[model samples]
Target chain A: MHPRRWTEFAIESLIRVLGLSSIGFVLLIFLFLLKEGLPAFLQVPPENLLGTRWYPTFDLFGTLPLILGSLLVTATAISIALPLGVATAVFVREVAPGWAREVLKPMIEVLAGIPSVVLGFFGMTVLAPLVRETLDAPTGLTAFTGGLVLAYMALPTIISVAEDALDAVPKSYRDAGLAMGATQWQTIWRVVVPAARSGILTAVMLGMGRAIGETMAVMMVTGNAARMPTTIDSLFRPVRTMTATIAAEMGEVARGSTHYHVLFGIGIILFVITFVLNLVAAGAIFKKRRRGGLR
Target chain B: MRPKIRVDHLSFYYGDKQALFDISMEIRERQITALIGPSGCGKSTFLRCLNRMNDTIPGTRLEGRVLLDGQDVYAPGTDVVDLRRRVGMVFQRPNPFPQSIFDNVAFGPRVLGLCRGRDELEEVVERSLRDVRLWDEVKDNLKQDALSLSLGQQQRLCIARVIAVQPEVILMDEPCSALDPIVTLGIEELMKRLREQYTIVIVTHNMQQAARVSDWTGFFWLGRLVEMGPTGDVFTRPQQKLTEDYITGRAG
Candidate 1:
C-alpha cells in the first residue's frame, strides 16, 4: 500500500512502452507501403486486375496473373496440408503409444525447425523432379509443385497446434464415452473431434497464413515467370506466383519508377491478403479461447 | 440365488506391484454391492477391474478369473468391446459430452449399433431418460447442449447414457463424490431403484452411504478384502478386527 505510487508508475510506463511500440511498428510499415504503393492505383490509366497479362517494360503492369497464381498455389497447398496435418495430429495425440509419442513429438518439432530454404530445395530435388517425370511435363516448377512443397513446409504448425488443441479436450469426456461403450475411434470423432473443432479451424487458418505468406519456398519451386497459372492436373509443370514476381522484379527496377511502384503494389496486395487471413485466424482463436482443450 | 458376477482368486498388478491380493467375491443380480474403504485401500481399483476399466492404463496387468454369468470375462478370446457393452461404468465426476443431452444418451446406442432407425433411437433415448427420471425435465430441451445442465443434472444424464445401451452390470466409481447432499440423495434413490433391474456396484468413501444403499458390502484394507457379507451384518458386527476398527472409527 505504501509503494502504490511506484508500482502503478512502473506498471503504467512498461505497458505504455510495449503497447505503443507495437502500434508504432505497424504504422511505420503501412505508411511506407501507402506512400510508395498508392500512386500505382492513380496512374493515367488504371491497371486491369482481372486480365492475365503483366508487361512492365512496355508501361503495362496488370497484376491479374500474379494474383491468380498466388491464389491457386495457396489454395492447392491448403487442400494438401489440411488433411495430412489433422490426421498426423490425431495419431500423435490419441493413438500413438508413449514411446512412439516421445520419439515422434520431437521429430515433428524438428520438422518445424527446418528452414524453409531446405524445404524449397527438397521440392527442387525430390518433389519437383518427381512431379516432372510423373506428369511428363516440360518443367517441375508449377503451382502444384509449390503447393506440395508448402504442404510439407507448413506441416508442423498445423499438426503441432492442432495436436495441442486435441490434447486440451477434458479427459472426462473421453472416459464418459468409453464407459458408455463408445470405441476409441467413436470417442475421438463424436466427442474429441467436435470439442476441438474451433481449435482445428484456428490451426487451418494459421497454416494457411504460413503457406500463403511463404516467399522463398514458393519462389524456388514455382517457375518464376509472369504468366497465367495454366491448367495442369499434376505438380510437374511451371507456374508463376505473386511473391516470386515481386521479389524478382523489385531488385531490377529503378527507384520512383512505375515498375518499382507496381512491385510495391504487389507487396501491398500480398500484405493485405495475409492481413485478412490473420484477422480470420485471430477471430477463430478468440472464439476458441474459452473452450480450453482436454483435461 | 445364482451370482451375476463371480470373482475368484482375483489379483491385480500395475506392472510388478500388486494392488489387489487374492480377492474373491460374488455379486448377486438386482442388488447394490458397495465396496467401501479409506484412500489407498484399492477399493476403487477393484471396482474398475470388474469392468476392465483398468486396462486403459498403461503397464497394468491382471491375473485370475472374473466371471459374468459363468463366462470368463478375461478369457483369451473375450471381446473387450462386447464385454464393455454389457457392463456399464459411471465415473466420480459428472462427465457429460460437449454435445446435446439427446446426443449424449444416443451415444452408446449409436456406437453399439443397437438401434436401426431414428424413431427407434428416439425410443431408446426416451426410455433411458425416463429410467433416470430426467425425461420430463429435458424432453423439450433435448437438443440443448449437455453442458447447459447443472452438475447434478449432468450426472443423471451420464446415467441415462449408460442405461441406454441396457447393460446388465453398472459399476460406479465414487459417483457422488463431486455432488452436494441433495444431489447425492437423488442419486442414492436412483441407484436403489436401478438395482431392481440391473446389478449395481458402487465404491464410496462415506461410511453411512454404504450402510444406507448397499445390500452386500465388501470392506477393503490396503490391497485386500478385509470382510464381505450382508451390509447390515458388516455394519453391526464385522468379523475382521480391521473391518470393525474401520467401522467403529478406531482406525482406517
Candidate 2:
C-alpha cells in the first residue's frame, strides 16, 4: 500500500476500535454490576428486600422507600422544569429579539456548565432554610427542596433541546401560517408547536433522565431519611433517594457485605430507569425522522 | 369593470439593498394577472407586497400604495390580519403544516373565528377542499397527515388552506415551479377555474404559462416593470424590445 493509504487505513481502524470499545465498556460495567448486586436479590428474603425499611446495620434491606423517594423527587423536578424550560425555549427561539437571543443562549449554556456540587452547596445553604420557614416543615432539607435544585439542574438540557426542535421547523410553515391570516401567536401555537411536539417530548424525557440520575444535589437537600413517601405532605418532608443512599453508605460499608451488594443493586436500578428514559427519548426522535424527516 | 387591486409607484428595500423599483399595475377583478421574469427580477417581491407578507422579514421596507377595494392596505392602523384574510397567498413550494388535512384547511377559519362551531368548520373545510378539487381524493383521509400526500395534492391542499379564509384575491408566487409538467398543467387549470370567483395573481418563470393563463401579463426586469398589457397583446404584439426579446427567448 502507498504510505498515505497505510496511514488512512490505520486511522480508520483506530476510529472503529474506539467506537466499539465504548459499547464494550458499557456491557462490561453492566456485567460487573450484576455480579456484585444479583446476590442481594437471591440471598435476602423477598419480603425483606421489598420492605420499606433500609437499615443496613440491622440486616434489614427494604428499598421501597428509596425507590419511591427517587420517583417523587424526579417527578417534582420534571413537573417544575418542563413548563419553565419549554416556555424559555419558545421565548428564545421565537419571540426574543436578535440581541436578547444571542445573550440568552450562551447564558443558558453557562447555567448548564455550573458545577452540580456548587448548586448543591447553594441549595444546602439557601433553599433548604427558605423551604423550612415558608412551609413550617420539620426540616429545611426535604424532597421538595431537592426537587427544586434538580429542576434547575435539568433546565438547561431541556431548554437547549427544545429550542433546537422548535428551530428545526421549516420557515415555510411560518410563511404559510402568516399568509393564512393567523396572528403571530396563533401561528406559533397552532402550527409551529404542534409540528415540533415529538421533539419537545424527547427533550422532556432526556431532562427527566438527567434529573433522576443526579446524585450530589439530591443528596445534599433531601435530608437522607429513607422513608416511604405516601402522603401528599411527604413532598415537604425529608427523603433519601436510591442514588444518595448508594453514594452516602458505599465508603463506610465493608466491601463484600450484603449492604455493599444492595448499594450496587441500587446502582443497577438507577441505571435501568435512566436507560429506559433514554430509550423512550431515542424512540421519539426516530419516529420524528421516519415521519418525513422533521418537515 | 373596476380593478380589484391597484399598485401605485411601489418600491421595496431589504436592509440596504433595493429589490424592487417604482412599479405600478392594476389587477382586474375576477381575472388572472401573471408576472413573468427571470429569477431575482423582483416579481415574487412584488407579489408579496400585495398582502404585506414581506413584513415578516426584518429590515424590509416598502414605499407606495397597494389598494384593495379602494383601501390602502399598507396604511397605518389597517388590520394586517384582516388584510391578509382578504388577500390570501400561495408560495413557490407546497408547504402544508405537519397536521391533518382537515385541520390544515380548517386552520384559517379556526384562527380567524370565522366558524361558529365544529359543524360549521367542517362545512368550510369541505367547501374549501371542493374549491381546490381535492375533496374526493382526500375526503376519506381528511384526518391523515398533510405531508403524506403527493406533491400535486399537497399543492392543492395549500390552495384549499388559503381558500378556507375566503380571500377575494389570491397571490401565487411561482405556485407550479416545483411540480412535474402534468401537475403543472393541472394547477394551471385550477387557476383558470379559480379566476371566475377570485382575482388571481401569479408569478412564473415560464413565459408560456403567462401567455396561456393570464388576462394581464407584466414583465419585470432588474426590479423595474418593463411592460404591462393584456396577455394577448404582450405576447403577440411587440411594443417594448425587452418584453419582445424575453417572450421570444432572446433575452430574459
Fnat values, candidates in order:
0.60, 0.82
DockQ of each: 0.51, 0.78
Instruction: For candidate 1, write residues B80-188 as lDDT tens digits.
Output: 7778888999889988887788998999999899999999999999999999999999999999878878889989999999999999999999999999999999999
**Candidate 2 wrong stretches, greater than 4 Å:** A1-17
lDDT of 2 by residue, A251-281 (tens): 8999988888888988888888888888877
Clashing pairs in 1: A168-A293, A168-A294, A169-A293, A169-A294, A169-A295, A170-A294, A170-A295
A43: Cα error in model 2, Å:
1.5
Query: RMSD of model 2, in Å?
Result: 1.6
> What is candidate 2's DockQ?
0.78
Worst ten-residue run, lDDT, model 2 chain A?
A286-295
Model 2's A-chain: what TM-score?
Answer: 0.95
Error of 2 at B87 (Å): 1.3
Tens-digit lDDT string for candidate 2 (B1-252):
899999999999999999999998889999999999999999999999999999989899999999998999999999999999999999999999998999999999999999998899999999999988999999999999899999999999999999999999999999998999999999999999999999999999998899889999999999999999999999999599998998899996
